[model samples]
Target: MTAIQLESASAQSKHEATLPELGLVCITVSQEVRFRTITRTRYLQFDQKERKKALKSIYEDNLQRLNSALTFCEKHSIKLYRMTSNLFPLCDIEDRIGENLLESMSADLAKIGERAAKLGIRMVLHPDQFVVLSSEKPQVVENSINILQTHARIMDMLGLPRSSWALMNIHGGKSGRGKELIEVISQLPENIKSRLTLENDENAYSTSELLEVCQNAGIPLVFDAHHHICHEKLDSYDDESVTEMFYAARETWDNPDYQLVHISNGKDAFKDRKHSDLITDMPSCYREAPWIEVEAKTKEEAIAHLRDWWEGET
Candidate 1:
């Protein structure tokens, strides 16, 4: 299987020499070559009798691809990875086939987790945008719970710790519904709640608002510097203000060493929500973060650029 290739020779050499001491930089989903994910539309194409069979086949392929991804990360000395939420497609539907994925694929999941642990890699998941637990509608909230439960089950099968270090990150939905979100979170099982993390978004919750909710819910907050700058309430991107927000978010985590921050440059301007192909300027505040997930369009290539830039400065 094809894997991410570091484009910069200097960056490659630098990582080989000094990556162990530096905090990890993560790449989302796939790099260079995208991993395969099946949509509900494609699943509907299969006949009723064949649907279960098709789902099993797709799931197995996804697990195999995940193993390949872990191998790629180990080879490149990339220690953090955000897994695709579509690893087990259609499993969230009430009447969906292959609902017993944990039982059927237990061995595969265990092996993947073992490989990651042995290689000293950290894995995380970010459920898609539709998981809105704070929605006022009961059905929407119920669906969101179902989706989150599915993610928690997968993490359990992988034998990951029940903590934010292997987080299932999501945005604060429906902006002023912190009370509703906290209530729903209280109802969830410990397995799901322990691994949950709230993040600030460009259009919705600002750093201050999310910090309050995270504090109430007893879960860690993921500080996104780009999102903080985009939100009108906290428009300044100065080092002092950003660093203060970073510290506030850091305090929410159980361990400061497990604190995860997101870094990205806008496609056009500083306030733009669209991520650029490479991160040109990272905040000085983020140097204190333990794990930084690069949100650039170029995926692992962007990480290579950041590594080169970081090495140049230090």
Candidate 2:
């Protein structure tokens, strides 16, 4: 299936036509979201048989809920979405039971992928913050690789392209380890490397820093505007400067048209790192980005609010 369908609307006609498709990350805030999980402690308590059963149950439930999530996105006309890293919770642990857990659910995963593709939804994934491939500790690096591999496997099972269009985005962990990061990325299996993307974090790597890493690693950079402002670099969030960064980030992508930009407003102030419930403004720079993932705390509701706000402004 095609990774993404480019929007026909021109950037200048953003208001006159539909605004760039906004993506909802992980869970939804407006309703009861079912992102089930199994703690390591709880898993340890169960017998071998029970552990396998529990893992299977949780994975199945998560897949069912994911189908529901896809349907919700289709109904709302949200063409972009970020799947939860916890979808298969605790399944990545070295001591976990059911080594073939994901394999068992291949049919379910294919169905979800087919549904998403049919609905014209562009799917992406962001593993939790702990996935640090550049860690000084060997075990940490191994564990991180395991986590990333699982994410890549999920994307493959869904039949998504092994490209940035079905990006598995993460931050450039442990700032200043750019060289080590590049080395680690170079060794990654094609499944993980081909679909991998680095994002600028609020405290660690600034846009400029990660941009260099992305360039070296031959991967696309997912620019997070909120993180840029909160970063120590403290550059002006003015339209001209942010737009310049946007364009620079765009060039890193194999296909600039599929570059993914993340958008979210600070909770209390422009510099606050905590995401607010809704986006108060759309950066003029966003016109240069085709797929903008709404990282607001309100999830899909934030996209709805942004749509309303955009319409009102126009």
Name the lDDT value of residue 123 in candidate 2. Answer: 84
- Candidate that scores best on lDDT: 2
lDDT score for candidate 2 against the true structure: 0.81
Model 2 misplaced stretches (Cα beyond 4 Å): 1-18, 232-236
TM-score for each prediction? 0.88, 0.92
Residue 228 alpha-carbon offset, candidate 2, angstroms: 0.7
RMSD of each: 6.1, 3.0
Q: Measured by C-alpha RMSD in angstroms, how accurate is candidate 1?
A: 6.1
How many clashes show up in model 1? 0
> Which residue pairs of candidate 2 clash?
none
Give the C-alpha miss distance for residue 88 in model 1, angstroms.
1.2
In the range 1-314, model 1's lDDT, one tens digit per residue, is 00111112222443455332122233343553245657778877878777777777778888887887887787767877888888887876555567775478898898898777777677888898999989989999888888898889888888877888679999989988988888888888898898999999887688889899899999999998988888854445565768889999999998776788898888988778888988887677777667788888877777777888888978
What candidate 1 gets wrong by more than 4 Å, as runs, is 1-33, 233-236
